[model samples]
Target: MKSNRGRRRDMQIAADNGDRLSKLPNDLLLNILERVGTLDAVRTCILSRQMLKLPTMLSQIVIDLSLRDLVRMNGVVADVTDKILSARSPQITIHKLKVKFLLSPSRCLSIGKSVARAMATQKLDAAEFEILTPRDFQNCTEAYLLLFAAQLNNFLHACPDAFAGLTRLHLQNMRFAELDITNILITCKRLESLCFVECDAGICSVLNVEHARLVEFTIAFGEFKTVELSYLPKLQRMTYNYWPCDDNPLVLGFVPQLSELNLTNAGLSDKTLELSQLLANVHTVRDLYLNFHSEKIWVRPECSWVLAPVLAQLRTVNLDNLPEECDFAWTMFFLEAAQCLEELCFTVWDHKCCRESQKSFSKKTDVKWEPSSIHFKHKNLCKLTIYGFQSDKNFTSYIRRTMKTAVNIQEISLHDRKVCKICAEKFPQMEARPSSYPRTDEEKDSLRKKIAAKPTMVASPAMIHFPS
Candidate 1:
């Protein structure tokens, strides 16, 4: 057996290390608790008498439980969350309170008041609540939605004036009406940022956002007839997943401070879409992104559509889905207009037009890349990136024009579109479809040599990159 003296020495060493942890200042100990995450920190309260009260003093609390845990625990998780929230000391100011939990009608009824009580007591800088939908969203009943909305409304109503100081609020995957949205915004008087994703607005035709302190906003996958931005003077960045092409268009009012705008699935038509009218007052935009779609070609001069306002402040532009069948001049209009543009990117995809037989690469093109204004040359242009490059005539013509006009160009990158691997093996048996894979390095080199030879080339030492 080990000697009694050796056992005493070993115990003394372990005691010294335990004392080091226990003797740490409460502030330093709290920092350690915060870094380990809320759940683990809360469990630390059981370590010793000193740790029992440490969780109550945390500056932030995050209650994150996935759907699997909720289903397996069968409502015990809600009880635990309630206990944790109830145990927090009111004097402790939480900087962030993030809760991501699966929601059901029954769970909402059980834990709604507990969550509201916690929110009302805490002074938070940022708050995010994500209510995950049921796995069978399509089969969800209307009664379930009614209960969920009722619980959420009650929680918002319980929010005290302390919630008004919240700087950011992100709500996702919930069905809320216009009244709920308005009430939440009005309650959070100092909210600077707001984001909503895949939220259903019940029977609401218009989402009128009239906030003074709000700066950034984003929305995706929602049904609303009109989104009216009226009195937002401090708004800076705005992103919409898809351009609003409903019966009524977005109303622009007093966004003089707006700088960046991004929209996916945009249209080039002036008849069905009112994008031109929407951009009338947005003259201060510096960065713009538009990903276009639709099979119909845009008639160039016949349509009489021009991007409103000479974007003197515009610096960066990203254009996607500019296919060969579409009017290439539509893109040229921006390059000619935005004289101060420093960076430009074009992304091509196979979703729009598909063919079986791959066409031979070409460097020569008949179309001219003439600027709308005779004196315009991209003096500030430095970088150009193109994805899904096939060395087609349209792209070759566009690049040739860019090389000639963008005198200060420094870098050019090319990426080929990716094809599904399994589908390629069956290409011979099937009808001709656009190959999803990029060109081989040898093929890319050949195309590069052909095009590099022809651009009565500008003298800048520009490097070309062809990434597989």
Candidate 2:
């Protein structure tokens, strides 16, 4: 039913609109180019003459050179990188550059040299390099390590001025000698954030960051080892997660500006005492997180006495996987010392202390443990959370004692399978309490009835479970 003339006019109008819309602004088109992979972006050049010249507008570059790809392309990979770097006129100012690859020792040296050369000429604000290969790390020989370290050293030395304007840097899965990292830190004087993930070298590395203006530092050691941290003077946040090594306690002497510290899966031997001493010396820390996993550990008792004085300034504390043999007395002493404590999370493992109560009940004995006493007072205590609770008289008594001691307590969260009705009856002034479990409709209705019977100050109970 359509006339040929009408059909042709409609087609012409749609083509005109498509042409107008396809011509995207330079910035918008560059954003689209950045989201695609390098190979895909290169393929876009063949789509049209306009796209042929659009690759130059990219200000961020990511190079992923896998071992298989490298073997397949042979010399083509390096050539492409060289061509890409050369094509940017007036020296492209890259905001970020990321390179990831698996390389042989010889290839690593060549790539490191090439990267150093590029860094020496390019103006980069941030950079990340990751090398992951099982062959390079499988019982690697000392000679191979030295060869890689030497090449990395040359690369770092070549770009001493490149990191002067950098704010972030991440280096992972690379083997570097002690002096290699030391030189990098010394050269990157303005780096504010630095991360070293799974980097290992023989001999404990010493980081001298006194002159560097670093704000955040995170180190995750693949192998159990120690690295010195005594020279960081301006660091604000530090996170350390590593396996235990036989190295001495890492001494942290001049990090006076630090405010937050997180330690996960960290083990301390007699050096635990040294860490306590160092914490006592720090006057600026406001938050501390400790996650311990070992049992029969007397580390806390020894450290608690030394850490008591410093606890006065702490505002928050989180303790996870606390051992059964850990002296609760020392823990209470430390808690009392925290005069301004606002939040507290205490998690015990395996319900060790609660089992004794069960045994006593079966034996028809009236044995009861004394409530943990407080020495210093927490005037600002408002929120308290306890995990791994059991339906035992001992735990109920502990909860009752906490409610009696905390005068300003406003919220309490108990993470347990079930709470004794007597314990809930005793705490009649808590607000905003909730459980971490699902309830049937009937049970939910019953809970609502019970809540209606209670006063507004007494909140409904909540359930919390440990992860499997």
Pick by TM-score: which candidate is best?
Answer: 1
lDDT of 1 by residue, 387-426 (tens): 7776677676667667777888888887776444544553
TM-scores, one per candidate: 0.72, 0.63
The number of the candidate with the highest lDDT is 1
Query: Which pairs of residues clash in candidate 2, taking residues 3 or more apart in a chain or in different chains?
Result: 434-462, 435-462, 435-463, 436-463
All candidates' lDDT scores? 0.64, 0.56
lDDT score of model 2?
Answer: 0.56
For candidate 1, which ten residues in a row score worst on lDDT? Answer: 359-368
**TM-score of candidate 1 relative to the true fold:** 0.72
